[model samples]
Structures are given as C-alpha cells and as structure tokens.
Target: MITVDFSRLTVSPGDRILDIGCGSGRHTCAAYRLKGVRVTGADLNPEDLKEARGRLTFHDQLGEHGGGAWNLSAADVTRLPFPDACFDLVVCSEVLEHIPDHDTAMGEIVRVLKPGKPLVVSVPRYLPERICWALSDEYFNANQGHVRIYRKSDLIARLERAGTRFLEHHYAHGIHAPYWWLKCFVGPTRTDSPAVNLYHRLLTWDIMKKPRITRFLDRLLNPVLGKSLVLYLIKRRL
Candidate 1:
C-alpha cells in the first residue's frame, strides 16, 4: 500500500513529515511509526480526515498504529496551512493529477519543505490509465475522481515547469492495473460485481498477506505494466 519506501527514501527519525491530500491517512500512519517522525495528515475531506483521526486514536489506544504520535488536519493542498520550510519530508501521492491548479499545489509543497527534502508523488501511469479510460466512460468522468491522465514523460515535464526538480522515478502497483481495467469495463462505481469483488479480495490479501509468489510476480510485472508511476523530487533552495 505504501508507494514511497521510507527506508529507501532516506526518511529519518524526528523528521517533520507532511502528507498533502492524505486521503484516509495511510501515509500519516506509516510516518508516525517511523521512529520519531512528526507526521501531519492533511486533506480536503473532513469526513475522511475525521475517520482517519479516529482510526489513529483507536490504534494508539490498542497499542497498534503509530503508538500515539501524529497530527491530522483538513485543508486545501493549494493553500496549505504550514509555514515555509516547515516539513523535512513531504508526500503528495496520487494527488497532483486530480488538481486543476497543480502548479499552485506544487509551489505550496515546495514552500513548506526544507532544502534537500525529497517529495514523493504518484499518479496513474498513462497506458494503464488510458486503457481504463478506453474501457469505460465512467472511469474518468466522475467529478472528483481524476481530472487528468498523465504520461511519465509529460508528468516529469510538468513537474519541471512547476518548479519541482525530479530526481528519479519508478513504477509500482502493477498488480492493480488489470483489476482496475476490469472494474472500468464493468462500471467504475459498481463494486458489487462478482468479478470486481473477487479482484478486491485478491488485492486485500496481496496487501495484507503479501504472499511470496504474488509479490514475486508483482515485482517482475511492475516495470512493464505498472499502474502507478512514483516520482521523487526535491525543492530547490534559492
């Protein structure tokens, strides 16, 4: 479920981490568990934010999830409520493609991150996403689901224009692409379909159990047919 591997990404204890557009606070939970990070979960969905906060609180009391040290806030990514150079690490996974003013949002992220801090961004890869779009009209038509599709080269070009210097990029979640194509073929919102249901169960198991066989297959398949392309970036200190 994690796109940015914190260990490989150079995240350290005590770093102040920001998760912009943090739906359900998956990143926040992980950050909190990373030794001594000060994690903040920011999102536009008050309902989701509230639910995420409740989940964190429950886990903390249960001696699980983060062990009681993370923050949650509801805010627009374009107009973040943090001061300049406030965060040591920033995560904007699967968010930029949805925003019409992605430049502004990127600027806000850069403004808040300290120099040399890497920002991780993830978006659906062009081919897989385009296939989904071709498979169903409902896939990209939902109001806030996804506003734009991104090709890797085009996305990197965009980041360059937005003032984010891309350092590296990699693909992930290859196993989820075909499942989504199936969903789009059936119906984007219709999760009750037998096919979708089956795939959902498989994905849940893959995420939770991470069976060795499936993980190996996913790794081999990821580069060629990955669903998401994750890019690492650094905000230039000028």
Candidate 2:
C-alpha cells in the first residue's frame, strides 16, 4: 500500500531514492518500479535486507520491475553510510517511533538528502496510536516496536529543528485504523475470533476490490481518523 504520493514528491525517473528502515521493502520495491531511479533499501536487520533483495530479484524475474538500479543495504538510520546530500528523495515511513534517538535519525535524513529534495516521513497518528496503546500492551512492547508516539506539531517541530523545511502533511490508511483498534481490543494475538475475522475479511475485500464505498469513506475519514500521519520536508542548504 503506497502512502506517499509520487507526484507530490515530483520524482524524476533518474532520481536517486532511499527507503530507510525499509522493512520487507514495500516502499523500496515501489520506488524501483518507478523505472530508471536508483533505489536503495536500507535497514539495520539483516533479514529485512535479505528479504528486500529477494523481492527485487523476484520482480526482475517477472519483468514487472523497473529499468533502474536497486540494492539492499544494512545501515543505521542515525548514522547512515551515504555521503552528504546524496539522495534525491528519502522515504522513512513508520520508522521514527521505533527509534529512541529519532532526532539523530532526522538529522541524518536532512544530511543525506540533496538540498531542495524531498523527504517523506510517516508515523502512527497520535489518537489512534494512543488508543492502541491503551488497549494492548503487546502493541508497543515487541522488540524494535514503537517507543514513542508523536503529535503532529511535535513531529513537525523536531524535523524543523533537524534542518528540514516543513512542506506539507497528509494522513493515510483511515480504513485500517478500526482494524487495529479491534485487534488491540480483543488482544493482538486473537485474530481467530469471529469479529476480528469478519473485519479482516472486509479489509481484504476493500484492498482487493477497491470498491467505491470504502474509498469514499476512507477519504472522508482520513483527515480526522487516519492511522498514519505523513509529513513532507525539504532539506535546506546549510
């Protein structure tokens, strides 16, 4: 499920893109399909890195992948291996909350992103995430799980402090918020229950069918109840 709007980010075909904390390489694979971009998927986990590479290889075999270059790397977000001002675009989705030193990670994003380029950062929205935390302790207690929740303003302020110019923001996955809330309510492990199973089926149908009703409902609800908050930032030359 692609959240960041490529058009809004104005990605050029040959642009260099980085997907930091690229677990399972969902977004990185998407970028590779953009055709002609050099895409890098970086994560601290060796397993995730391996999986990302495997996905890229699979895409290449199927001929569904792009013509551009793509690679997977193991790297820390707070201390990235890239040179300063290297990438044309950087995507850090659902990642900041997992880092204890998110400010340092943000600084690295700003440092490696070329001046005037875009950085897309997303996290769980405060209210929905707060509700999840209240409902289940398992939600945030896992290894490498969320350590903090960020209000929109606080997130923006921190990015600005790290030297990124605030551009704009949006919300996504409104339909998924209730699914998670239900999971939290019943216990994250209890997906076999009837109510949760029904909801899961509905979500699967919505994702597969893209029915008009759910799409309309999600658009209406996203502003108020989106599960994720997506922020756009630009690096300023310092």
Candidate 3:
C-alpha cells in the first residue's frame, strides 16, 4: 500500500529516487516500477534491507520493474551515504516519528535532494496517533516504535525550516485507523483477540481486492479520519 501520491509529484525517466527508512521496499519498488528511474531503498535495519532486496528481485523475476534500475542499502537517515544534491526525488514516509533526531534526518534529506526537486514526507496523523497512545502504552513503547506525534502545522514548519518549501498535503489510510484503535484497545501485541483478527482479515482483503465500496468509504472518510498525513515539498535552491 503506497502512501505517497505519485500524481502529485513529477517523476521522469533517468530520475534518481531515494526511499529513506524504506522498510521492506514498498515505496522503493513502487518507484522502481516507474520505468527508467534509478531507485534506492535505504534503511537502518539489515534484515529489512534483505527483505527489500528479495522483493525487488521478485519484481525483476515477474518483469514488473518496467526497465528501472534498483538497489538496496543499509543506511541511517540522520547521516545518509549519498553525495550532496544527488537525488531527484526523496520519500520519507512513516519514519520521522521513530527518530529522536528527526531534525538532522530532515536536513540530510534536503542535502541529498537536488534543488527544486520534490520530497514526500508522511507521518501518522495526530488525532489517530494520539488515540493509539492513549489507548495503550505498548503501541508506542515497543522497540523502534514511534517516539513522537506530529501535528500537521508543526510537521510542515519543521520541513520548511529544513530547507524545503511546502506545496500541498493529504491524508491516507482512513479505514485502517479504526483497525489500529481496536488493536490498541485489545493489546498491541496480542494475536488472540477475535475482533482484532477479523479486522485484520478485512484490511488484508481490502488491500488485495480493492473492492469498490471500501474504496469509496476510504476516500470519503480520509479527510477527517485518515491515519497517515502526507506532505509534498520542494528543496530550496541555494
């Protein structure tokens, strides 16, 4: 399930794209399928990188890559390995809230992105995330879990301060918010709850089937109940 809206951003053949904290290569593989783009999926976890590489290889086997080149790297967001002004586009989704030094990571993203290029950043929405935190400590207290919750205004200000100009914003995963709330209520790590299990199956079905009713409801409710907030920005020219 891709969070960043490709239609809102411009990507062309030969462009280089970076997916920071690219857990399991969801966005990385999405970008790779754009045909002729060079996509890199970078994360701090070696295991996640390995998984991403496997997924990318699977895409290659299935001929789903659209002729794009791809690579996976184990890298920290706060101190990336790429050269300055090297990437045409950067995607940092569901990642910043996990980092204690998110400001430095933001700066690194701007440093690597070419001036005037687009950057997409996403985080859990404040209301939904706050609800989860209120519902259960385990939701946020788990290892590598979210350490902060971002109000839309604060997040936009942060990225703007990091040398990116905000363009637009949107919300996503509206239907999934309730599923998480249920999990938080039941117990974040518990798998035995029948309600939670049922909801999980529903979500999995929606993701795989893309039924019309669920899609309509998801779009309808996204404005107010969306779990994820996605922002679009462009790096400032020096």
Instruction: For candidate 3, write residues 108-185 as lDDT tens digits.
Output: 999999999999999999999999999998999752689899999999999999999999999999999999999999
Q: How many residue pairs clash in each candidate?
A: 0, 0, 0
Query: Candidate 2, residue 190: CA error in Å?
Result: 2.5
How well does candidate 1 score on lDDT at residue 132? Answer: 90
- Evaluated at residue 145, the lDDT of candidate 2 is 84
Give the CA lDDT, 0 to 100, for residue 54 in model 2: 90
How well does each candidate superpose onto the true structure, as a TM-score?
0.93, 0.94, 0.98
Model 2 misplaced regions, further than 4 Å: 142-144
Residues 10-121 of candidate 2: C-alpha lDDT, one tens digit per residue: 8877899999999988899888888689999999999888888898899889887668989888999999999999899999999999999999999998889998888999
* Candidate 3: stretches off by over 4 Å: none
lDDT accuracy of residue 79 in candidate 2: 94
Q: Superposing all C-alpha atoms, what RMSD in Å does each candidate have to the true structure?
A: 1.8, 1.7, 0.9
> Of models 2 and 3, which has the larger lDDT?
3
Predict model 1's lDDT versus the native: 0.83
What TM-score does structure 3 among the candidates reach? 0.98
Candidate number that wins on TM-score, 1 or 3:
3
Candidate 2, run of 10 with poorest lDDT: 137-146
